[model samples]
Target: MTRLVVLSLCIGMVSAASVMSAASAAGPAPSGTAGMLFNHEHLNNGSPGWNETGVRLNYTLAPRHAFELAVARTERFDLRDRQLSALYVAPLSRELTGSLEANASSTHRVLARNAFGTTLQYEFAPAWLVHGGVKTTRYDTVRVNQALLMLEHYFSNFSWAVAWRPAHAFGTNANSAEVRASYYYGDKNTIGVILAGGKEAANIGNAVTLTDLRSAAVVGRHWLNREWALNYGIGSTRQGDFYVRNGMTLGVQYAF
Candidate 1:
């Protein structure tokens, strides 16, 4: 599933790292730097429904350098019609860091889900980061290749994150874990309180399809100007035969 379509666009941007969280004074930009982000998701995993669109590009290849590219498209309203994901990110260092990325995907009956797999990343601080990869998939799977780890923290108003994925036949699993608490009085408003649960299993070579799931999510953010910003979130996923009633995301970002 193209690594689940880049992990479902990383669950709608993962709070955009708290909107870049201040600290912006590393001058020299204007040699062609740009920013754009748009995301939409409305999934009703009952019978036939899913409409997803994602577009991202943040560019600057100079002073301190930068580059990111993401493309996603999903349309399934009558079953069978999918062109999943594409991504590329590069920014080697400015502090303990590293990067390398690639992914080409399609799978959810649209077929063809394997052709690219190359990911290696490392980051030390600023909420630390790490990823080790190799993904290739098909039916009757019993370990195409897998090893993934993700951890995130933004403490203060409270935050927590977790991910441990092993895909052979769902041997090692815990694909998600999140705990959150938030509050921001005014001027860049934010009010939140959320609790999440996780577990996902996909047995290789589908016995048709096998998956166990769990979920819970609620988040919100607002700042009408200074380059535009508004975010809304809702979540629910209880899988047995797949069911996620309400999940939403709307975002905009620009700062150059």
Candidate 2:
């Protein structure tokens, strides 16, 4: 179903942690900096394929303060949908940071009508961080709410993270967990692997269903120069009693 497709997209993009971790790995960009990114992804489940194209713009207003806007178009099951999203991140303190994100889709037939999320991260010790977040998503026929907690550690050029998420939807509850490990290399370059498994609720043919899912992915970013970078990901997912999906993503970023 569409919920499974959304999960695939999350794996292909490596989730929000990818963005936050990459920023930590590369350190902060100068204030007044701006960047643009273009991304394309393709996914198949042994039948008709799904594709998504997206663009994102990011601007840094000051140290530890930034904003992002993005738009995406997706084609799946012979239907097309468009979504718009925005995010703001700021420092609550020297050791605490917070972010808020909201998104909406033009069509709710296959995507969520709207969603909002907020996260707070704190560094309690050198090279160690903890994050907590909550999100709510409204679909055409159902509303899902989720809470997440994550812990991360950095040493030398390597970083490791683990997260747990609990979700409620359609009067049912489910849980999932994920782990990621990344290595930083060169200037603003990183490579990482992610593994996740869990149960989730999905909308299927007018009925809400709870299903099991598992996914794995490898993602990376490489700087071609001071102003250009390439991002790539490849992954696969298994949706219980449904389908197996394999996908790849490629993107480019430019900064000024």
Candidate 3:
């Protein structure tokens, strides 16, 4: 569910990229709506180490729809079990928009959980975006379904977004929820922070467990040419005192 909602926002960012291009253009700038990037990172904060290099493509299908495809393989993560996703952006009105998406995987490793999901979005106001949806687990015994609601505002080159949701971790009726938000700043450089707390049920034992996570990220981008660019971000995740991981990514992209 979080994956889909974020993709919707990414779609919006792609559309806004075009709009920003228009706003910056003296005349008609080349109307190219697709941007592709190749990203790499050697990052490890607390969990299994991850060194990844992958490519991602983001583009528009129409004035109201967008699509994205990404494939990345870590040292331990399977290359065959990659990531691919799509989104349908709907505009309820000029300033209001909505979207739907599917985030799926080709294989479910031990590390894989909630590998597939569906999402929906509603933009009730210009300063706020609302969303709700659900997702389920892809493997055995464990059945986790999640629903979320989010609100966000965009101002100039920066924006803030926050959301809360109920997550049911199958095998029991107990449900838990979490709230998280991130803020970005600058024309291209950005920083973000997230705070989340929730609970979940164990699939095998049916025991309930509290889930709390904190995250912070720093990103930088540099455009070398009209069709070439670079992007990098570093972030850390704290999942209680038991599990923690730090991740970093860098990519060079060429768009046609």
Candidate 4:
């Protein structure tokens, strides 16, 4: 009965990535455009685990150029932290785009002290894109470096992507891979499934370590009207020798 309840809730909620990435993937809003997003998440592992609340603001300066600011509060394992993040996206050419992001935390007990990343996407062929990025994160005990390469293709209203991510931390290397499939129904409306597995480097309570990780999630966004939309994700994660987490996220976005 407990497992059934969790499954039901998962089916109704959204993924964390879906809520955050949906806006960026849809491209820049109109010039002088502004938007806001409110997000909440909960995770459990037999006991009360993590709860998070976040808000993000976005503005477009011109066509193909935009920036976003976000703030989040997280509570887990009796520790609380606040995080701030900023992102900028712009077009490099007709077939190329780039993004840069940076983030910092008020406390490093359960989060990274700071992190920075950049990514570039190029349309190499019709309906096909290639992406590459690198990131570095500073934690209380260790620094983690990571990189990713991905290929994506779109057909009709469906899209598929596969990505490889590699990381090094604590004098160890970890490799992870993921596959995603998405369906687009209307303007900025999408649903997707993501599956990922392998080893990952994570910061856990001031310690950075490598762990075997496996996860799956279903995520989506649905536009309620012209200016309002709903985002949701439901997922589970298994970390070897650590813990299993079942989580759900919900978010709302409004544009003006």
Candidate 5:
């Protein structure tokens, strides 16, 4: 039953592409040379529940080139997890661009895991962008490989983006996908919906767990002034056989 539900959701995201409209959760950080975002998320999937806190920084070095740094900490039922990642983006030409990312994570169970990846993007037509990427992750003695594809389009009032990722670990294969659509209105208010789910394997405290994770929620953001904004969302997820209900997410952003 879990497998069937996940497959149906994946197909639905793809089919909606033909007729749906724009941007993603809160839309891209307003384009600028420097910016900061603070985020918080709470989720329960019939388990003890978890909360994640994160912050990200972005800097644009030159036209079409940027750098980003992010840090996150997660509170699980019994332990905590931490992660840090960096990304670099550069445009090769007017219609082509590329990005590279490196990540490291640690937890009470899995001492550490490292990942490196790259992505290529192309603007094939006006307001249409396509992207593909590959990533390799290494734990103490396990390696996981992932491949991804995404499509994004911008409309006059909204924007839409979808991504599919397939991963291989422990001699098994799993798939995941994400869908986002956001509409912009008023001076700086934006409303959006997000969905992410799939069946995958995860490493927790040196043990491997096969997880059936799924979540869907509606989110929105309101800009109070030129430098301050607020964001919030509500959602639920299913983790393994447990269900997390009424999950809440919130965030604040500052731009200079």
Candidate 6:
């Protein structure tokens, strides 16, 4: 029973890591030229866990350039994983934009990863867009490569986005697809939902097997004033038969 519990915990961590890895690789930025964000998450399923308070800051220096920095920690059982990342965005043309990002993570007492990626987005119409990017990460002696593609559409008060990502790491392959939709109201308030899932290989000891993953969430944001806002969400995830994870996120943001 103890061994089974440990195995389940590792699988859950892998499931979470896969999603975070893809989402952080190449993503669209939200409106508002600059802001500071504070976020927290509490999860229980495979093993009770919670993410340490996360912080992010974003600023647009000009019409053509922007910068962002973020930090977060995840605690599972008695171990902790910490991550830090930085990103820069610049316009390549009136309809094209490019972004560069760098990230590092440490798990427990050992360095876990160092990664970098570049992404390019093209606006085909006022409301339609496409983007693609490639990322590379080094995990000790192993290297991982990832490719990403996304399509997005925006209306006056609603937006939708979809993405496909495939990656190779540690002698295994993983792929994921994600969809998100949001509707805006009262100029600053919004409600949204997301659905995402994927498959990856998990190697335990000498056995290699495939694991299926699924996750969904509903989120909302409300503004108290012109500068202060609240964000909240609840979600659930399944990692094959290893365990089911359910979680909630709470956040606050200040716009400048």
Question: Which candidate achieves the best TM-score against the true structure?
Answer: 2
Q: Model 4 segments beyond 4 Å from truth?
A: 1-47
The number of residue pairs in model 2 that clash at the backbone is: 0
Provide the overall lDDT of each model, using Cα atoms, as 2-decimal numbers. Answer: 0.42, 0.69, 0.43, 0.66, 0.61, 0.60
For model 5, give the 10-residue run with minimal summed lDDT.
1-10
Pairs that collide in candidate 4 are 13-233, 14-232, 14-233, 14-234, 15-232, 15-233
Sorted on lDDT, highest at the top, how do the candidates line up? 2, 4, 5, 6, 3, 1
Task: Give the C-alpha lDDT of model 3.
Answer: 0.43
Evaluated against the true structure, the overall lDDT of model 5 is: 0.61
Give the better candidate number (2 or 5) by lDDT. 2
Q: Comparing 4 and 5 by lDDT, which wins?
A: 4
Give candidate 6's total backbone clashes: 0
Per-model TM-score, in order, reads 0.24, 0.87, 0.65, 0.84, 0.76, 0.76
TM-score, predicted candidate 1 vs. hidden true structure: 0.24
Off by over 4 Å in 6: 1-46, 107-112, 140-142, 200-210
Per-residue lDDT tens digits for candidate 6, residues 27-97, read 23343433333333344444545445567776755543667687767564445678897877777887777
Per-residue accuracy of model 2 over 1-256 as CA lDDT, tens digit each: 0000011235412234434433333345534334333334343444456677888777766645677788888765566789998888887888778888899998855667898988887778987888888888888777888888989888877778898989998788889898878777875677878888898665432455667878898877777988887778788877677666677777777777
User: How much is the lDDT of residue 236 in candidate 1?
Assistant: 60
State in Å the error of residue 200, model 2.
2.3
The better-scoring model by TM-score among 3 and 6 is 6
Model 4 global lDDT (CA atoms, 0 to 1): 0.66
Q: In angstroms, how far off is 13's CA in candidate 4?
A: 18
